[model samples]
Target: MYKLICIDLDGTLLDTRQRVSTKNREAIRKALDQGIEVAIVSGRPNCFTIRIMNQISGRMGHITFNGAYYRIANKTRQFPIPKEAVMKVAKLAQKYHVRTYFKNKNLSLCTKSDPGILDYDQFKSQTPLKDQMDMLYNVDVVDVLSNQDINILKIFAWDENLENVRKMREELKEIEGINLYLYDENFEMSSEDTSKGKAIQNVCADLGIQLDEVVCIGDNYNDLSMFEVAGLSVAMENAPRKIKEMVDKVTLTNDESGVAYAIENFVLKENE
Candidate 1:
Protein backbone atom coordinates (compact mmCIF):
# COMPACT_ATOMS: atom_id res chain seq x y z
CA MET A 1 0.00 0.00 0.00
CA TYR A 2 1.31 3.43 -0.89
CA LYS A 3 1.42 5.83 2.03
CA LEU A 4 2.55 8.89 0.15
CA ILE A 5 1.97 10.23 -3.34
CA CYS A 6 4.37 12.85 -4.77
CA ILE A 7 2.89 14.47 -7.86
CA ASP A 8 4.37 16.95 -10.31
CA LEU A 9 2.10 19.96 -10.96
CA ASP A 10 2.38 21.51 -14.41
CA GLY A 11 2.18 18.64 -16.82
CA THR A 12 0.92 15.94 -14.51
CA LEU A 13 -1.69 17.33 -12.13
CA LEU A 14 -2.94 20.25 -14.15
CA ASP A 15 -4.48 19.58 -17.51
CA THR A 16 -3.26 21.26 -20.72
CA ARG A 17 -5.67 24.13 -19.99
CA GLN A 18 -3.84 24.61 -16.68
CA ARG A 19 -6.77 23.77 -14.42
CA VAL A 20 -7.53 20.88 -12.12
CA SER A 21 -10.55 18.86 -13.15
CA THR A 22 -13.41 18.10 -10.76
CA LYS A 23 -12.91 14.39 -11.37
CA ASN A 24 -9.28 14.67 -10.32
CA ARG A 25 -10.25 16.62 -7.23
CA GLU A 26 -12.73 13.93 -6.19
CA ALA A 27 -10.13 11.26 -6.78
CA ILE A 28 -7.61 13.06 -4.58
CA ARG A 29 -10.21 13.69 -1.89
CA LYS A 30 -11.02 10.00 -1.87
CA ALA A 31 -7.35 9.15 -1.46
CA LEU A 32 -7.02 11.57 1.42
CA ASP A 33 -10.09 10.05 3.00
CA GLN A 34 -8.34 6.71 2.82
CA GLY A 35 -5.49 8.19 4.92
CA ILE A 36 -3.03 8.62 2.10
CA GLU A 37 -0.88 11.74 2.20
CA VAL A 38 -0.60 13.59 -1.11
CA ALA A 39 2.14 16.07 -1.90
CA ILE A 40 3.13 18.15 -4.91
CA VAL A 41 6.73 18.29 -6.05
CA SER A 42 7.58 20.78 -8.76
CA GLY A 43 10.08 23.18 -10.23
CA ARG A 44 7.67 26.05 -9.45
CA PRO A 45 7.94 28.25 -6.38
CA ASN A 46 5.71 27.65 -3.35
CA CYS A 47 3.82 30.84 -4.03
CA PHE A 48 2.50 29.41 -7.28
CA THR A 49 1.86 25.89 -6.00
CA ILE A 50 -0.20 27.11 -3.05
CA ARG A 51 -2.60 28.91 -5.34
CA ILE A 52 -3.31 25.73 -7.26
CA MET A 53 -3.99 23.88 -4.05
CA ASN A 54 -6.57 26.47 -2.97
CA GLN A 55 -8.90 25.52 -5.78
CA ILE A 56 -9.55 22.10 -4.31
CA SER A 57 -9.19 22.96 -0.61
CA GLY A 58 -6.37 20.42 -0.85
CA ARG A 59 -3.71 20.38 1.82
CA MET A 60 -0.32 18.86 1.14
CA GLY A 61 3.41 19.46 1.57
CA HIS A 62 5.36 20.76 -1.40
CA ILE A 63 8.89 20.34 -2.74
CA THR A 64 9.62 23.46 -4.73
CA PHE A 65 12.51 25.07 -6.61
CA ASN A 66 13.05 21.64 -8.06
CA GLY A 67 13.48 20.44 -4.46
CA ALA A 68 15.65 23.21 -3.07
CA TYR A 69 12.99 24.16 -0.53
CA TYR A 70 10.46 22.02 1.26
CA ARG A 71 7.20 23.74 2.23
CA ILE A 72 5.05 21.74 4.62
CA ALA A 73 1.95 23.12 6.28
CA ASN A 74 2.91 26.78 6.63
CA LYS A 75 6.56 26.40 7.57
CA THR A 76 9.27 26.62 4.92
CA ARG A 77 12.63 24.88 5.17
CA GLN A 78 15.56 25.61 2.90
CA PHE A 79 18.74 23.80 1.93
CA PRO A 80 21.29 26.54 1.41
CA ILE A 81 23.54 26.66 -1.61
CA PRO A 82 27.08 27.97 -1.25
CA LYS A 83 27.46 31.66 -2.01
CA GLU A 84 30.70 31.18 -3.91
CA ALA A 85 29.09 28.74 -6.28
CA VAL A 86 26.15 31.07 -6.85
CA MET A 87 28.54 33.90 -7.71
CA LYS A 88 30.32 31.77 -10.26
CA VAL A 89 27.07 30.88 -12.01
CA ALA A 90 25.96 34.50 -11.95
CA LYS A 91 29.22 35.46 -13.62
CA LEU A 92 28.63 32.89 -16.34
CA ALA A 93 25.10 34.15 -16.97
CA GLN A 94 26.56 37.62 -17.30
CA LYS A 95 29.22 36.40 -19.73
CA TYR A 96 26.59 34.90 -21.95
CA HIS A 97 24.28 37.94 -21.79
CA VAL A 98 21.34 35.87 -20.59
CA ARG A 99 18.56 36.87 -18.22
CA THR A 100 18.48 35.24 -14.79
CA TYR A 101 16.05 34.64 -11.92
CA PHE A 102 17.17 33.73 -8.43
CA LYS A 103 15.91 33.02 -4.95
CA ASN A 104 17.97 33.33 -1.79
CA LYS A 105 17.18 32.52 1.83
CA ASN A 106 15.09 35.68 2.24
CA LEU A 107 14.33 37.01 -1.19
CA SER A 108 13.33 36.28 -4.77
CA LEU A 109 15.19 38.28 -7.41
CA CYS A 110 15.03 38.39 -11.16
CA THR A 111 16.96 40.07 -13.98
CA LYS A 112 14.15 39.76 -16.48
CA SER A 113 12.42 43.08 -16.90
CA ASP A 114 9.06 41.58 -17.86
CA PRO A 115 9.27 38.01 -16.50
CA GLY A 116 8.49 36.86 -20.03
CA ILE A 117 4.79 36.37 -20.85
CA LEU A 118 3.76 34.63 -17.66
CA ASP A 119 0.41 35.83 -16.31
CA TYR A 120 1.49 36.45 -12.74
CA ASP A 121 -1.95 37.67 -11.67
CA GLN A 122 -3.93 34.73 -13.03
CA PHE A 123 -1.28 32.17 -12.19
CA LYS A 124 -0.77 33.33 -8.62
CA SER A 125 -4.12 34.59 -7.46
CA GLN A 126 -4.05 32.68 -4.17
CA THR A 127 -0.46 33.41 -3.07
CA PRO A 128 0.28 36.44 -5.13
CA LEU A 129 3.79 37.73 -5.85
CA LYS A 130 3.02 40.72 -3.64
CA ASP A 131 2.41 38.32 -0.75
CA GLN A 132 5.72 36.60 -1.42
CA MET A 133 7.50 39.95 -1.62
CA ASP A 134 6.02 40.90 1.73
CA MET A 135 7.24 37.70 3.35
CA LEU A 136 10.67 38.13 1.78
CA TYR A 137 13.29 40.28 3.46
CA ASN A 138 14.06 41.91 0.15
CA VAL A 139 13.20 41.66 -3.52
CA ASP A 140 15.08 43.06 -6.47
CA VAL A 141 14.67 43.31 -10.22
CA VAL A 142 17.88 44.59 -11.70
CA ASP A 143 20.69 44.10 -14.16
CA VAL A 144 22.60 40.83 -13.86
CA LEU A 145 25.63 41.24 -11.62
CA SER A 146 28.75 39.13 -11.59
CA ASN A 147 29.51 39.70 -7.89
CA GLN A 148 26.18 39.68 -6.13
CA ASP A 149 26.34 38.53 -2.51
CA ILE A 150 23.52 36.05 -2.24
CA ASN A 151 23.00 32.46 -1.09
CA ILE A 152 21.14 31.26 -4.16
CA LEU A 153 18.59 28.48 -4.23
CA LYS A 154 18.20 28.26 -8.00
CA ILE A 155 19.04 30.27 -11.10
CA PHE A 156 17.15 30.03 -14.38
CA ALA A 157 17.91 31.52 -17.77
CA TRP A 158 15.58 31.64 -20.78
CA ASP A 159 17.12 31.89 -24.20
CA GLU A 160 16.36 30.73 -27.70
CA ASN A 161 19.96 29.75 -28.20
CA LEU A 162 19.99 26.16 -27.02
CA GLU A 163 23.66 25.90 -27.91
CA ASN A 164 24.52 28.75 -25.56
CA VAL A 165 22.62 27.04 -22.76
CA ARG A 166 24.37 23.78 -23.58
CA LYS A 167 27.76 25.51 -23.57
CA MET A 168 26.97 27.12 -20.24
CA ARG A 169 26.10 23.72 -18.82
CA GLU A 170 29.46 22.32 -19.96
CA GLU A 171 31.37 25.34 -18.61
CA LEU A 172 29.72 24.98 -15.20
CA LYS A 173 30.51 21.27 -15.04
CA GLU A 174 33.85 22.22 -13.48
CA ILE A 175 32.17 24.01 -10.55
CA GLU A 176 32.46 20.76 -8.53
CA GLY A 177 29.28 20.95 -6.44
CA ILE A 178 26.60 22.44 -8.64
CA ASN A 179 23.94 20.73 -10.76
CA LEU A 180 22.76 21.95 -14.14
CA TYR A 181 19.73 20.93 -16.16
CA LEU A 182 18.32 22.12 -19.44
CA TYR A 183 14.53 21.97 -19.64
CA ASP A 184 12.94 22.96 -22.90
CA GLU A 185 14.47 26.37 -23.70
CA ASN A 186 15.51 27.21 -20.15
CA PHE A 187 18.66 26.38 -18.22
CA GLU A 188 18.27 25.62 -14.48
CA MET A 189 21.17 25.83 -12.03
CA SER A 190 21.19 24.51 -8.49
CA SER A 191 23.54 23.39 -5.73
CA GLU A 192 26.13 20.74 -6.61
CA ASP A 193 24.09 17.73 -5.52
CA THR A 194 20.51 18.88 -4.90
CA SER A 195 17.68 17.32 -6.92
CA LYS A 196 13.99 16.46 -6.78
CA GLY A 197 14.92 12.92 -5.71
CA LYS A 198 17.04 14.12 -2.80
CA ALA A 199 14.24 16.43 -1.72
CA ILE A 200 11.71 13.57 -1.86
CA GLN A 201 14.11 11.42 0.19
CA ASN A 202 14.37 14.15 2.80
CA VAL A 203 10.60 14.54 2.99
CA CYS A 204 10.06 10.79 3.28
CA ALA A 205 12.60 10.58 6.07
CA ASP A 206 10.86 13.40 7.91
CA LEU A 207 7.57 11.51 7.72
CA GLY A 208 9.12 8.09 8.50
CA ILE A 209 8.09 6.70 5.15
CA GLN A 210 10.11 4.45 2.86
CA LEU A 211 10.83 5.42 -0.74
CA ASP A 212 8.92 2.36 -1.97
CA GLU A 213 5.79 3.70 -0.30
CA VAL A 214 5.75 6.75 -2.54
CA VAL A 215 4.42 7.24 -6.06
CA CYS A 216 6.03 9.90 -8.27
CA ILE A 217 4.42 11.27 -11.41
CA GLY A 218 5.80 13.78 -13.89
CA ASP A 219 6.36 14.67 -17.58
CA ASN A 220 9.73 16.33 -17.97
CA TYR A 221 13.46 15.67 -17.74
CA ASN A 222 13.70 17.55 -14.45
CA ASP A 223 11.40 14.90 -13.01
CA LEU A 224 13.73 12.01 -13.93
CA SER A 225 15.49 12.03 -10.59
CA MET A 226 12.23 11.64 -8.70
CA PHE A 227 11.13 8.89 -11.06
CA GLU A 228 14.32 6.97 -10.32
CA VAL A 229 13.67 7.00 -6.58
CA ALA A 230 9.93 6.38 -6.54
CA GLY A 231 8.48 2.87 -6.15
CA LEU A 232 5.80 3.42 -8.81
CA SER A 233 6.66 6.04 -11.39
CA VAL A 234 4.04 7.42 -13.81
CA ALA A 235 4.47 9.53 -16.90
CA MET A 236 1.87 11.79 -18.48
CA GLU A 237 0.64 10.76 -21.91
CA ASN A 238 2.14 13.87 -23.44
CA ALA A 239 5.60 13.23 -22.01
CA PRO A 240 8.51 12.67 -24.34
CA ARG A 241 8.97 9.11 -25.52
CA LYS A 242 12.21 8.77 -23.58
CA ILE A 243 10.58 9.86 -20.31
CA LYS A 244 7.57 7.60 -20.89
CA GLU A 245 9.91 4.65 -21.45
CA MET A 246 11.45 5.19 -18.00
CA VAL A 247 8.21 5.08 -16.02
CA ASP A 248 6.34 2.04 -14.71
CA LYS A 249 3.03 3.22 -16.15
CA VAL A 250 1.50 5.68 -18.60
CA THR A 251 -1.93 7.08 -17.86
CA LEU A 252 -4.39 9.17 -19.87
CA THR A 253 -3.00 12.31 -21.45
CA ASN A 254 -2.90 15.50 -19.40
CA ASP A 255 -5.74 16.76 -21.59
CA GLU A 256 -7.85 13.83 -20.42
CA SER A 257 -7.18 14.15 -16.68
CA GLY A 258 -4.29 11.69 -16.70
CA VAL A 259 -3.33 12.37 -13.09
CA ALA A 260 -6.80 12.00 -11.63
CA TYR A 261 -7.41 9.01 -13.87
CA ALA A 262 -4.30 7.31 -12.54
CA ILE A 263 -5.25 8.02 -8.94
CA GLU A 264 -8.84 6.83 -9.32
CA ASN A 265 -7.93 3.73 -11.31
CA PHE A 266 -4.84 2.76 -9.36
CA VAL A 267 -4.48 4.29 -5.89
CA LEU A 268 -8.11 4.83 -4.91
CA LYS A 269 -9.50 1.65 -6.40
CA GLU A 270 -6.82 -0.40 -4.70
CA ASN A 271 -7.91 1.01 -1.35
CA GLU A 272 -11.55 0.17 -2.09
Candidate 2:
Protein backbone atom coordinates (compact mmCIF):
# COMPACT_ATOMS: atom_id res chain seq x y z
CA MET A 1 0.00 0.00 0.00
CA TYR A 2 1.13 3.51 -0.65
CA LYS A 3 2.29 5.25 2.49
CA LEU A 4 2.84 8.71 1.06
CA ILE A 5 1.10 11.00 -1.41
CA CYS A 6 3.26 13.83 -2.68
CA ILE A 7 1.09 16.30 -4.59
CA ASP A 8 1.88 19.51 -6.39
CA LEU A 9 -0.33 22.46 -5.50
CA ASP A 10 -0.53 24.66 -8.57
CA GLY A 11 -2.30 23.05 -11.48
CA THR A 12 -2.56 19.78 -9.59
CA LEU A 13 -4.43 20.09 -6.32
CA LEU A 14 -5.41 23.75 -6.71
CA ASP A 15 -7.38 24.80 -9.74
CA THR A 16 -6.71 27.87 -11.84
CA ARG A 17 -8.47 29.86 -9.13
CA GLN A 18 -5.58 28.88 -6.81
CA ARG A 19 -7.91 27.25 -4.29
CA VAL A 20 -8.15 23.63 -3.25
CA SER A 21 -11.36 21.97 -4.39
CA THR A 22 -13.68 20.32 -1.91
CA LYS A 23 -13.38 17.04 -3.79
CA ASN A 24 -9.61 17.23 -3.60
CA ARG A 25 -9.70 17.95 0.11
CA GLU A 26 -12.04 15.04 0.71
CA ALA A 27 -9.72 12.68 -1.13
CA ILE A 28 -6.77 13.90 0.85
CA ARG A 29 -8.63 13.42 4.11
CA LYS A 30 -9.65 9.94 3.00
CA ALA A 31 -6.06 9.06 2.36
CA LEU A 32 -5.07 10.45 5.72
CA ASP A 33 -7.77 8.36 7.37
CA GLN A 34 -6.37 5.33 5.58
CA GLY A 35 -3.10 5.84 7.40
CA ILE A 36 -1.36 7.49 4.43
CA GLU A 37 0.56 10.69 4.60
CA VAL A 38 -0.14 13.58 2.26
CA ALA A 39 2.35 16.36 1.69
CA ILE A 40 1.79 19.68 -0.08
CA VAL A 41 4.70 20.01 -2.45
CA SER A 42 4.84 23.24 -4.41
CA GLY A 43 6.99 25.87 -6.06
CA ARG A 44 5.39 28.47 -3.76
CA PRO A 45 6.84 29.90 -0.57
CA ASN A 46 5.96 28.64 2.90
CA CYS A 47 3.70 31.58 3.64
CA PHE A 48 1.40 30.72 0.75
CA THR A 49 1.71 27.00 1.39
CA ILE A 50 0.69 27.49 5.01
CA ARG A 51 -2.30 29.52 3.86
CA ILE A 52 -3.37 26.70 1.61
CA MET A 53 -2.91 24.12 4.36
CA ASN A 54 -5.08 26.23 6.64
CA GLN A 55 -7.83 26.15 4.04
CA ILE A 56 -7.98 22.38 4.25
CA SER A 57 -8.63 20.10 7.23
CA GLY A 58 -6.08 17.32 7.16
CA ARG A 59 -2.65 16.64 8.57
CA MET A 60 0.10 17.28 5.99
CA GLY A 61 3.71 18.24 5.77
CA HIS A 62 4.96 20.66 3.14
CA ILE A 63 7.64 20.40 0.49
CA THR A 64 7.65 24.01 -0.60
CA PHE A 65 10.10 26.05 -2.68
CA ASN A 66 9.90 23.38 -5.34
CA GLY A 67 11.39 20.86 -2.93
CA ALA A 68 14.16 23.07 -1.63
CA TYR A 69 12.46 23.14 1.78
CA TYR A 70 10.56 20.54 3.76
CA ARG A 71 8.45 21.30 6.82
CA ILE A 72 6.64 19.00 9.20
CA ALA A 73 5.20 20.06 12.52
CA ASN A 74 6.94 23.34 13.33
CA LYS A 75 10.45 22.23 12.36
CA THR A 76 11.88 22.42 8.88
CA ARG A 77 14.88 21.33 6.85
CA GLN A 78 15.80 23.73 4.09
CA PHE A 79 18.40 23.94 1.36
CA PRO A 80 18.23 27.68 0.80
CA ILE A 81 20.06 29.07 -2.22
CA PRO A 82 23.35 30.69 -1.32
CA LYS A 83 23.27 34.43 -0.74
CA GLU A 84 25.58 35.03 -3.68
CA ALA A 85 23.51 32.91 -6.02
CA VAL A 86 20.30 34.55 -4.82
CA MET A 87 21.70 38.02 -5.50
CA LYS A 88 23.09 36.94 -8.84
CA VAL A 89 19.66 35.90 -10.07
CA ALA A 90 17.97 38.86 -8.46
CA LYS A 91 20.37 41.30 -10.11
CA LEU A 92 19.94 39.57 -13.40
CA ALA A 93 16.18 39.75 -13.08
CA GLN A 94 16.35 43.44 -12.27
CA LYS A 95 18.71 44.11 -15.16
CA TYR A 96 16.39 42.38 -17.59
CA HIS A 97 13.27 43.97 -16.06
CA VAL A 98 11.87 40.48 -15.67
CA ARG A 99 9.48 41.39 -12.80
CA THR A 100 10.83 39.06 -10.17
CA TYR A 101 9.69 37.95 -6.71
CA PHE A 102 11.80 36.60 -3.87
CA LYS A 103 10.77 34.17 -1.13
CA ASN A 104 12.54 34.75 2.16
CA LYS A 105 11.91 33.06 5.53
CA ASN A 106 9.05 35.13 6.95
CA LEU A 107 7.59 37.15 4.08
CA SER A 108 7.92 37.11 0.30
CA LEU A 109 9.43 40.21 -1.30
CA CYS A 110 9.29 42.17 -4.53
CA THR A 111 10.48 45.55 -5.72
CA LYS A 112 8.68 48.48 -4.09
CA SER A 113 9.12 50.34 -7.33
CA ASP A 114 7.15 49.41 -10.38
CA PRO A 115 8.43 45.93 -11.19
CA GLY A 116 5.75 45.52 -13.89
CA ILE A 117 3.10 42.84 -14.01
CA LEU A 118 4.21 39.46 -12.63
CA ASP A 119 2.82 36.14 -13.87
CA TYR A 120 3.13 34.12 -10.67
CA ASP A 121 -0.08 33.63 -8.69
CA GLN A 122 1.16 35.14 -5.42
CA PHE A 123 2.54 38.14 -7.25
CA LYS A 124 -0.83 38.82 -8.82
CA SER A 125 -2.86 41.73 -7.50
CA GLN A 126 -6.02 39.92 -6.41
CA THR A 127 -4.67 36.93 -4.53
CA PRO A 128 -6.94 35.74 -1.70
CA LEU A 129 -4.28 36.25 0.99
CA LYS A 130 -5.71 38.25 3.90
CA ASP A 131 -2.62 40.28 4.79
CA GLN A 132 -1.05 41.90 1.75
CA MET A 133 2.24 42.39 3.55
CA ASP A 134 2.32 38.77 4.61
CA MET A 135 1.80 37.67 1.03
CA LEU A 136 4.66 39.85 -0.23
CA TYR A 137 7.06 42.41 1.13
CA ASN A 138 7.31 45.36 -1.21
CA VAL A 139 10.72 46.88 -0.64
CA ASP A 140 13.98 47.95 -2.18
CA VAL A 141 14.74 44.43 -3.41
CA VAL A 142 18.47 44.97 -3.86
CA ASP A 143 18.88 46.44 -0.39
CA VAL A 144 16.83 43.62 1.08
CA LEU A 145 19.05 41.01 -0.57
CA SER A 146 22.19 42.59 0.88
CA ASN A 147 20.97 41.80 4.38
CA GLN A 148 23.05 38.77 5.41
CA ASP A 149 20.43 37.19 7.67
CA ILE A 150 17.79 36.74 4.94
CA ASN A 151 17.13 33.06 4.29
CA ILE A 152 16.01 32.93 0.67
CA LEU A 153 14.01 29.95 -0.41
CA LYS A 154 13.35 30.76 -4.05
CA ILE A 155 13.78 33.36 -6.82
CA PHE A 156 11.32 33.71 -9.68
CA ALA A 157 11.38 35.87 -12.81
CA TRP A 158 8.38 35.97 -15.05
CA ASP A 159 9.03 35.06 -18.69
CA GLU A 160 8.23 38.06 -20.83
CA ASN A 161 11.09 38.04 -23.31
CA LEU A 162 12.31 34.74 -24.72
CA GLU A 163 15.49 36.44 -25.91
CA ASN A 164 16.23 37.62 -22.38
CA VAL A 165 15.60 34.14 -21.01
CA ARG A 166 17.91 32.68 -23.62
CA LYS A 167 20.53 35.23 -22.75
CA MET A 168 20.14 34.45 -19.04
CA ARG A 169 20.48 30.71 -19.62
CA GLU A 170 23.68 31.26 -21.57
CA GLU A 171 25.04 33.70 -18.97
CA LEU A 172 24.20 31.68 -15.85
CA LYS A 173 25.01 28.26 -17.27
CA GLU A 174 28.36 28.10 -15.47
CA ILE A 175 27.10 29.55 -12.17
CA GLU A 176 27.94 27.16 -9.36
CA GLY A 177 25.76 26.09 -6.39
CA ILE A 178 22.36 27.05 -7.90
CA ASN A 179 19.75 25.14 -9.84
CA LEU A 180 17.52 26.95 -12.34
CA TYR A 181 14.62 25.71 -14.45
CA LEU A 182 11.66 26.99 -16.44
CA TYR A 183 8.06 26.36 -15.45
CA ASP A 184 5.86 27.95 -18.09
CA GLU A 185 7.37 31.40 -18.66
CA ASN A 186 8.93 31.74 -15.21
CA PHE A 187 12.61 31.22 -14.47
CA GLU A 188 12.84 29.57 -11.04
CA MET A 189 16.13 29.36 -9.17
CA SER A 190 16.95 27.30 -6.10
CA SER A 191 19.77 25.24 -4.57
CA GLU A 192 21.67 22.72 -6.71
CA ASP A 193 20.43 19.68 -4.77
CA THR A 194 16.78 20.81 -4.66
CA SER A 195 14.11 19.03 -6.68
CA LYS A 196 10.83 17.25 -6.09
CA GLY A 197 12.31 13.81 -6.65
CA LYS A 198 15.26 14.40 -4.35
CA ALA A 199 13.05 15.97 -1.69
CA ILE A 200 10.58 13.11 -1.85
CA GLN A 201 13.43 10.65 -1.59
CA ASN A 202 14.74 12.46 1.44
CA VAL A 203 11.28 12.54 3.02
CA CYS A 204 10.75 8.88 2.27
CA ALA A 205 14.05 7.95 3.80
CA ASP A 206 13.19 9.97 6.87
CA LEU A 207 9.74 8.43 7.21
CA GLY A 208 11.12 4.93 6.61
CA ILE A 209 8.92 4.56 3.55
CA GLN A 210 10.40 3.27 0.31
CA LEU A 211 9.99 5.15 -2.96
CA ASP A 212 7.71 2.42 -4.20
CA GLU A 213 5.28 3.26 -1.43
CA VAL A 214 4.65 6.75 -2.78
CA VAL A 215 2.20 8.14 -5.33
CA CYS A 216 2.68 11.57 -6.85
CA ILE A 217 0.44 13.87 -8.88
CA GLY A 218 1.39 17.00 -10.75
CA ASP A 219 1.02 18.90 -14.04
CA ASN A 220 4.17 20.77 -14.92
CA TYR A 221 7.80 20.48 -15.95
CA ASN A 222 8.88 20.75 -12.30
CA ASP A 223 6.64 17.80 -11.52
CA LEU A 224 8.63 15.63 -13.95
CA SER A 225 11.21 14.85 -11.32
CA MET A 226 8.61 13.60 -8.86
CA PHE A 227 7.18 11.37 -11.58
CA GLU A 228 10.58 9.73 -11.88
CA VAL A 229 10.63 8.75 -8.20
CA ALA A 230 6.97 8.04 -7.50
CA GLY A 231 5.67 4.49 -7.56
CA LEU A 232 2.74 5.78 -9.61
CA SER A 233 2.44 9.19 -11.19
CA VAL A 234 -0.79 10.95 -12.16
CA ALA A 235 -0.80 13.82 -14.58
CA MET A 236 -3.66 16.31 -14.76
CA GLU A 237 -5.69 16.63 -17.95
CA ASN A 238 -4.82 20.31 -18.03
CA ALA A 239 -1.15 19.30 -18.20
CA PRO A 240 0.58 19.49 -21.50
CA ARG A 241 0.35 16.49 -23.74
CA LYS A 242 4.10 16.04 -23.39
CA ILE A 243 3.75 15.77 -19.59
CA LYS A 244 0.80 13.39 -19.85
CA GLU A 245 3.01 11.05 -21.84
CA MET A 246 5.48 10.96 -18.96
CA VAL A 247 3.11 9.70 -16.28
CA ASP A 248 1.33 6.40 -15.60
CA LYS A 249 -2.15 7.94 -15.85
CA VAL A 250 -3.96 11.15 -16.67
CA THR A 251 -6.87 12.36 -14.55
CA LEU A 252 -9.48 15.08 -15.03
CA THR A 253 -8.42 18.69 -15.09
CA ASN A 254 -7.93 20.61 -11.84
CA ASP A 255 -11.21 22.44 -12.40
CA GLU A 256 -12.81 19.05 -12.58
CA SER A 257 -11.25 17.86 -9.35
CA GLY A 258 -8.60 15.76 -11.08
CA VAL A 259 -6.81 15.14 -7.80
CA ALA A 260 -9.98 13.71 -6.34
CA TYR A 261 -10.65 11.66 -9.45
CA ALA A 262 -7.13 10.25 -9.35
CA ILE A 263 -7.42 9.34 -5.70
CA GLU A 264 -10.92 7.87 -5.78
CA ASN A 265 -10.39 5.74 -8.87
CA PHE A 266 -6.75 4.88 -8.45
CA VAL A 267 -5.67 5.12 -4.83
CA LEU A 268 -8.87 4.41 -2.92
CA LYS A 269 -10.31 1.84 -5.30
CA GLU A 270 -7.13 -0.17 -5.53
CA ASN A 271 -6.79 -0.34 -1.77
CA GLU A 272 -10.34 -1.52 -1.47
For this target, which candidate reaches the highest lDDT against the unseen true structure? 2
> All candidates' TM-scores?
0.84, 0.82
Which residue pairs in model 2 clash with each other? Answer: none
lDDT by residue for model 1 (231-265), tens: 88999999999999999989888788888888887
Model 1 regions more than 4 Å off: 73-76, 104-106, 118-125, 128-150, 159-170
Q: Judge candidate 2 against the unseen true structure and give its global Cα lDDT, from 0 to 1.
A: 0.78
Instruction: Evaluate all candidate structures by whole-model CA lDDT and list the values in order.
Output: 0.73, 0.78
What is the clash tally of candidate 2? 0
- Candidate 2, 99-151: lDDT as tens digits: 56777545567743334353244533433353222435346667777875677
Give the residue spans of candidate 2 off by over 4 A: 73-75, 90-98, 111-147, 159-169, 183-186
Candidate 1, residue 209: how far the Cα is off, in Å: 0.8
